[model samples]
Target: MSTLVVRRAPITRVLRSELRMVLRRPRTLIGLGLLALVPVLMGIGIAIATANGEEGGAEGLAALVIGNGMLLPIFALSIAMAMLLPLTGAMLAADALAGESAHGTLRGMLMAPVGRGRLLAVKAFGVASVTLIAVLLMALTGIISGVLLLGGDGMLTASGTSLPFLDALGRVLITALYVTLQVWALAAVALAVSAFTEHPLIVVVVSLGLVIVSGVLAAIPALDWLDPVLVTTSWDAVSEVVRDPIEWGPLVEGGLRALCYLVIGGSIAYSRMLTRDG
Candidate 1:
């Protein structure tokens, strides 16, 4: 009688593998490299333009050049949040399942001991991890660049109040986490679209298209009420958190809105992955 050793793949192991693969890709490296440049370029340009914060726009440019180390990340986030972060999320997630299917490897993934739902959960987590890292890197780069060029001594609140360095750092972190939630939800929707197609390009295009459509519609007066519900409308939720007193309403609603989409998108992807032969 031969006793067989059974090897079970834990979700953590799966997640690790996914992360390793994602990070090793040349495209990922290049994208992150370019993203890291955004803050550096912005910092340099602002420093030169404002004469290193000695000229005009002092009040307006304080966070960016106000010589506040803690506020540097927040300023960087403001630049990227409008488009780069969202596009980064869509690109990172667009290939999760679709690329596998397009290359005929998805069937092999399904054949693994891991369940389809668990596999997708793992993929989503992996992509979210990368997206989160990207956000941090952007902020980190900003902090470094700002300190080198402008300085980071006097942290200021939107209300013109001074903040301790530690307090400002804390708020910057909170904002990064808030941005992470946004990407995580967006990843799920992109993954769902990926499940139905074998083209990763289609997955990315459609995911972004949905955002553009919702954003445009939300801007219209006739659809003002829908702003609260549109997937793209909560991008500014973090702005509320950095202020003094810290209003939590928009933050909570933004998180829940993302959670709702995560459920719907993950469910759709799971069901489709299970039923589809290829």
Candidate 2:
């Protein structure tokens, strides 16, 4: 009897393939379109609302329209991270494992000498890359629209203090990166859930449901103690950087949550795949 050995695909190849597969999908493009659309619509609506010398509402990120056009990216990112980003993340990640299974590619890939754990990690990374790109795109589009529609270079804090435009841009970049990190837990959860099922929709829906539940609970005064454990608590904390002597506590908390969820969820997904003989 004789046996032949085959080479496994390189991690880069796997990642590139995953990226192509994920990005080429109509759903992913649709999600990206929706994300980019939000800021444009927001900018136009705000422009109309404040047309003819009407006063801008000094409430939340909405007030950014009157402050600085660059600030609109931050506002757009805030909304995207809240629901749009996570939902898109869920869609991407939930499909990473189960979607392959749905398409009958999982078994073929496993037989390709690919390490199960590495495969899962690569898929997660690919999805993360898509999501990170989405965040950047949303921010860029928002900034461009804001610049053209709203038109300003000065910055304002929630408290109405003014800062140099350069300082504001730096904070916006920091906040965008920080928020990007915070939202990975949604992908992590979806990845974990994705391992056990062949049905991508179920994984997507359930992962999104869990995230929504966490967000809802975090809002209730009774669930205040659960903030540390919730995946979303630190997500919006990047806004803290907008303040002078920027607050570090919330960002730290959010970073820690993101780390914990990624490790725990990734571990479970890895273990589940490792055990499956398929």
Candidate 3:
């Protein structure tokens, strides 16, 4: 009987290694530090907007928080995706092959017992995991800052209705999830772009440019058809989630669109990574 040796490396181990590598980089640290400042600035802005006679009473504060907060999460998601998603994807994908090739470590790794497919799977998992963490952190910070600054006593709507605190909290959570899905779609695009470039900066710039172009195209009146096709177009779904009755249509449609993008992007990325001569 032939004995078979299964690859025993867990995805967590690969994720940890990737995380360590990311933390060791100065640019990664700077990006993280800048992300940490978003909530603080949001809180400060809220305070300024609500200060002394400008918006009197809890109702005014609530109005400002709810209407403004609805948009803030979306903006945070957009900014985070635009800036960090590409960097993370580059670190994961470009570094996975290019960095190893540059250091001549890929040859050694190829000689190891690990299968290329397994390596690629673990690398994708690590990239996705980091993207999720970044999204959660940004959402949590934005919510906390908004609630603290504007006071989460009662939810005020643009239509002038007040929802209970618990209801508002639920909406906030849902909005966060929506934003997360949108960001995930952006990360997938970055990963796809990363597979094309050996230079990390090139991957980052290309991914960012892709996102910007999608946004620009989606804005044009004649390009309405491209709106649903663009990955970044559904980024505004979080706002819809915050609205009354919590419209599920946009969220559902946006999620499905994102899923399509993820599938297509991941396929392209996987194909490139597997076929390349790194």
**Which structure among the candidates has the greatest lDDT?**
2
TM-score of each: 0.91, 0.91, 0.80
Q: Write the candidate numbers in order of decreasing lDDT.
A: 2, 1, 3
Q: Provide the clash count, candidate 3.
A: 0
| Residue 207 lDDT (model 1) | 79
Residue 3 CA displacement from its true place in model 1, Å: 5.2
Per-residue lDDT over 61-144 for candidate 2, one digit per residue giving the tens place of the 0 to 100 score: 676556368778888788778788888888888778899888888878777667777887788888899989888888888878
Supply candidate 1's per-residue lDDT for 20: 94
lDDT of each: 0.78, 0.81, 0.64
Stretches of candidate 1 off by over 4 Å are 1-6, 52-66
Q: How would you order the candidates by TM-score, starting with the best?
A: 2, 1, 3
Off by over 4 Å in 3: 1-7, 52-63, 66-107
**Alpha carbon deviation, residue 26, candidate 1 (Å):** 0.8
Worst lDDT window (10 residues) for model 3?
Answer: 58-67
Pairs clashing in candidate 3?
none
Q: Candidate 1 or 2, higher TM-score? A: 2
